[model samples]
Target chain A: MLYNAFLQAIREIKRNMMRSALTAIGIVIGIASVIAMVNIGKGASASITQSVSKLGSNNLLILPGQTRGGPGGASSFAKPFKPNDLNVLKSSINTLEAVSPVENTSMTVVYKDQNYRTNIKGVNNDYFTVQSLEVDLGRKFEKSELRTGQSACIVGKTVVKKLFAPDENVLGQKIRLKNFSCVIVGTLVEKGANTFGGDQDDLILVPTKMFQRRISGNNNIHMITVSVKKNIPLEEAKLQIDQVLRESRHIKANDEADFTILSFTTLLDTISQITAILTVMLGAVAAISLIVGGVGIMNIMLVSVTERTREIGIRMAVGAMAADILIQFLIESVVLSALGGIVGVLLGLAITYGVAIGLDIQLILDPSITVLSLLFSMLIGVIFGISPARKAANMNPIDALRYE
Target chain B: MIKLAGITKTYGSGEVATQVLKGIDLQIEKGEFVAIMGPSGSGKSTLLNILGALDVPTEGDYSFMDTNIRGLSKDQLALFRRNILGFVFQGFNLLKKTSALANVEMPLIYQGVSAKERHKRALEVLSSVGLQERVDYDPGQLSGGEQQRVAIARAIVTRPKVLIADEPTGNLDTKRSHEIMQLITGFNREGITVVMVTHEEEMAEYASRIIRLRDGMIEKDGHHAV
Candidate 1:
């Protein structure tokens, strides 16, 4: 009996082939977009975590701001920290591993006869260790080179590629930056673009003393990065630095601090939380589309019940139980939904792959999620198909037979 | 054998109450051929529907082979209809999209007969109705006479004990009507009691007895002039 009913359901679906196909299209597109968006979100999240992990977790950045607990709290875009304040923190903190006061300058670099606009950063040798950077060629600046403020520099991989051809050696070459000439002593390893859509390998690095004296002629540093010992807890290290900076700057008790210290791990957590919330909001929007598709299925099933009223009457007249009619309609709805799901999976994967290539991100498809979404669509069919099927099954055979 | 005592059927309610059948008492012995005849609204169709168990009288005791039928549930009546009786309608009532063979096999399927057995029995009955060559043709492709023949084949496919037809020749010409009446008579001769309704006296002559109704009551009951 079940087999016959199943065959009948399939035959009925085939009888209205065009309408059935159109009805399934809605579910297919809805499910496809959901899968593509979810997978892209997952891949983007993984890439972000990996990139943040590359920056040492023990690293922290401190920037000068307005003193808190005055009339108003500190504003984020206020003046930056000065080099003297960084020196005081470096000399006073005992648990600190290294400190680098960083200043940025944009200049047209002249290598031989070719010149290009590049970002130049001035920092001591400790900046490499604090940022967890490795040199691919030559070596980091010598301690004497930083103290004496020599005109020596390390070039990023992008500058190296632009100024020098692949076959030629760029190490030990001289590049002119603004008012002075500097010799390249090493090349930094290739670090790809950062989250803010900037290439990490498009900058030149020189000693802080050289930049303060020769290039910018300024005492203020744009940023200060502090590296703490591995054994020290991050929060404890932050508190100790805060106290030392307060005393060095001569701030009284019950006074707000004069600077903001931010740990890399905390920043990572904040960014990840924001992205997760966005992903959930977007997923909810996709779910609404699926609901719309479910309603479409219900509408079509209702029409189908009306169209087959005579068949229903005949079946009931010949001794089929009411539940049998209900089951047949329910099975047809599920079959339509499942077929839509299968086609939707393929479409979503194709879209994801295309977008991943176009935007250059990873395509990470989770099988568990795909299966769950497919099952959820089938559940939607059953949930939505029941009322219409019951309505059809409950029809009086006498009235149904009389229907034209 | 089937018996009806004080059967009454009415439609609507209150001031517009219209009775379709009233105080109908009738009987048919096993293997007997019977016909019911009346003009439009004379209640012949309503009586036939009640006698076939397709409907229930508003007030009546309907007994089929000594079992009270009016008290049977819809599902029980459906089972009773499938196992012991068959129906032939004026419209032929074959599923339009299916073959004559499949239509003939449908009642047996409801009886839960296996596919091989159903196919064998449907083939046998189709041949008995002279539709052996048209068994695989859909009802839409067949002529009116052939379609009615297929309906007869389906009605007798399960070897039902009683065959009830409502206006079996209402849609056919004289020759086809004669052919259909002949088929019903042959089944009756084979020990399946036949109850048929017709307005034509020629068709009524084939039955062993005739019951005429008027104003929702039986006006005459006797053998036709065959």
Candidate 2:
């Protein structure tokens, strides 16, 4: 009996093909938007995770001043770290693998007549090791260059492109900065963009001793990069470094530390949390359309029931029970919504694929979301279809037959 | 075999109430061809609806073949209509956009007949009604007379014990009307009880018995000479 009703519903839908297509439009758009938003959000999240992890997940940053609280706070006026603090941290913490004091300043680099404004960072060879940076061409600085503070530098990929022609050999080139000229001994490999939208391969690297004496003419270090030993837990290493820095800086237990320590894991967690929230927000906004689509279905179904009053009477008069009529109409709605869901999913996937390709990110299709979307649309059909089906079922055959 | 005692049907309630069938008693025997005749608003259609089980009387004791119809639930009434009764309407009431064979197969579908049997039986009945070549044509594509033949084919497809037709030929021309009467009488001669409602006295002449109704009451009942 139900099988016959199903076929009957299909025939009705096919007979009114234009109206059926118009009615399904709302569902199609609703489902398509939901799928596209979720898929693109997932792809973006994946890209962020990859880039954050690429910045070396085990590294820690030490910045001079408390990051929180008011401007007149105790640590607000604290002095920056010096070379002595770097040595003390290295000698005190057993879990420390390598530490490098880094100082940076924005300046212009000129090779011949071409010049570009870029950041110049000064650090020892340990900075490259701690950051997992590799030299793509030429070699690292010799010990004498670090000790005597020689005017030697390694340029990043962005600097090389800006300061030299494609055919020019960058290793033996001389780039002038401020009033001093430095020989480029190496060029670091490319590391693409970071999560913060900054290009990681757009800087020049020089020995810390050279930068402090020749450029800034100061002994203060702006920041310090530290790497924990392979087997040591990051939290344990953080605690040890925090305790040692407090003690060496002569800060009492009751006083707050003058510096802040940030671990890579903490940064990764914060970034992931933010992206997850954004994904959910976008998905929710897209779901509103789905609900609206359901309402559209209900509206059309109500109109359909009213239009087919006499047809219902005919079926009832021919011995069709109320249940049969109800089932037939309900089946029609379910099939319509289910068809919309299928088309929406396919369209969403196609749009997501196109966006991933355009943005140069990995395609992420969450299977669970796909299945849930299909199920939810069908649920919309049933939830909205009940009233109309009941109206059709409860009609009096005599009155219906008499209806002109 | 059918019996009706004091059947009364009223529309609405309170001061607006209008009684359509008032205190009517009638009996119909198996294989009897009866035509109910009346003027407009005389309740002949109401009486046919009550006999078809399409509507329940306001007050009545109705029985067919020993089964009390008033005591049956809505689903049970529907089952009774499916198994023991067939209805033909004035407008020919064939499903729109449906083939003639499919229209005739509708009652059998509710009877839970298998597809193969339904197809074979529908084809056989369509041929019996002289619509064998028009089996696949929809009602819109067939002439009015052909459409009436399809309705008749649908009415008798289930081989019901009783066929209730309300003005089955009311929309046809004189020639088509006589042809339809001839087809219906042919079925009545084969032992199927038929009760039809019509206002035309000439159409009533084809029935073996004629019952005239006036003011919701029976005015006359007698047999017609062949």
Candidate 3:
């Protein structure tokens, strides 16, 4: 009996193709937007995780002052890290693999006639080891150069491309920085764009003493990068670093510490949490359209029931039970919604693919979400189809037959 | 065989209340060709609806073949309609867009008959109605008389014991009306009980017995001389 009803429902839908398509429009848009939003959100989250991990997952950052609402904004009472602080962390912390003090300032770098404004980072030899940076060409700064604060510097891939011709040997080439000249001793390997939209390769690296004496004229370091030893949990290393910094800076037990310790894992967690919330919010907004689509189905079904009163009467007189009529209409609605869901899925996947390619992120199609959206759309059909089906089933055959 | 006692049907309530079927009593025997005739506003159609089990009486005892039909549930009534009763309407209520063969096969579908058996039986009935060449034609493609024949084929496809027809020839011309009456009388002679409602005296003349209703009450009941 149900099979016959199903076949009849299909025939009815085909007979009123235009009306059926119009009725399904709401479901189509609802499911499509939901799929697109969730898929794009997932891709973005994956990209964030990848970029965060690329920056060395186990590395920890120690800022000179407490982190405020904005980056690099220190409190008036906070103090900066000195060279002695770097030594203290290196010698005292057993979990530390390397410690490097860093100071940065943007400067115009000139080589021949080309000049590009880029960040200039000043650090010790330990900075390269801490950041996992390897020289792709030439060699790192010699110990004599670091001790004497000579005018030898290393350029990143972006600086090398911006300063010299393609075939020009970047090593041994001279670049000028604000009336000072230095020879490029090495060119660092490429590191793609960071999550913050900054080019990781757009910088030049100089010895700490050279930057302090020749550039910023300051002995204070802005931040410290610490590499935790392998097999050491980040929490243990963080605790040890916190204790050592607190005691070395003479912080009182009752006072809040002046410096903040940030780990890559912590950063990754914060970013993931933010993206997860955004994804859910977008999905919820899209779901509203699906619900509206369900309402549309109910509305159309009601109208259809009324329009087919005489037909319902005829079926009833032909010995069709109330349940048969009910099932027939219900199946029609479910088939409508299920069709809408399928089209929406295809559209959503297409939109996701477009967005992933446009944003240059990996396409992550979550199978569970795809299946879930399909099921959810069908559920919408049933939930909204019941009242209309019941109204049709409960109609009196006598009156229905007499209805014009 | 069917029996009805004190059947009353009222519509609405309070100030708007109106009674469509007043207290009435009637009996119909098997294999009897009975015709119910009445003017407009009479309760002939209402009585037919009640007899078909399409509506329940407000107060009555309805017994069909010794079973108390008044106590039957909705599903049971449906089963009774499916197995024992057939109906024809003035509008030739064959489903639109459906072929004559499929329309004839509808009652059997409700009876849960297998597809092959339904097809075979429907084809045989269509042939009996002289519509074998037009079995696959939709009702809209057929003339009013041909449509009525298809309706009759659908009505008897299940070999039902009783056929209830409401205005079987109201929409037909003189020749078609007589032809439809001939079909009804032929089925009656084959031992199928038929109860039909018609306003035309000429159509009622073809029945074995005629009952005239006025204001929801029977005014005349007699055998028609052949």
Candidate 3 segments whose C-alpha is farther than 4 A from its true place: A68-77, A166-170, A192-197, B14-16
Residue A197 in model 2: lDDT: 76
Worst 10 residues of 1 chain B by lDDT: B48-57
TM-score of chain B of each: 0.98, 0.99, 0.98
Q: Chain A alone, TM-score for each of the models?
A: 0.85, 0.90, 0.93
Task: Tell me model 1's lDDT, rounded to 2 decimals.
Answer: 0.84
Q: TM-score of every model?
A: 0.87, 0.94, 0.94
What are the lDDT figures for the candidates, one per model? Answer: 0.84, 0.88, 0.88
Model 3 C-alpha lDDT per residue in residues B26-102, reported as the tens digit of each score: 99999999999989777899899989999998888999989999999898888888888889999998788889998
- Native contact recovery (fnat) for each candidate is 0.28, 0.57, 0.51
Best by DockQ: 2
Per-model interface RMSD values are: 1.7, 0.9, 1.0
lDDT by residue for model 1 (A1-404), tens:
77876777678778789998888887888788888888878777767777776777888877666534331344646565665677778887777898998788799999887888999899987898897777999999998888878888899989988888788888888899887899999999988878668898999999888898888786667677889988988898898878877776677768977777777787678768877887788778878888888899999999989988987776665556667779889888877877787888899889888888787776789887689779978987898789889988788765676678
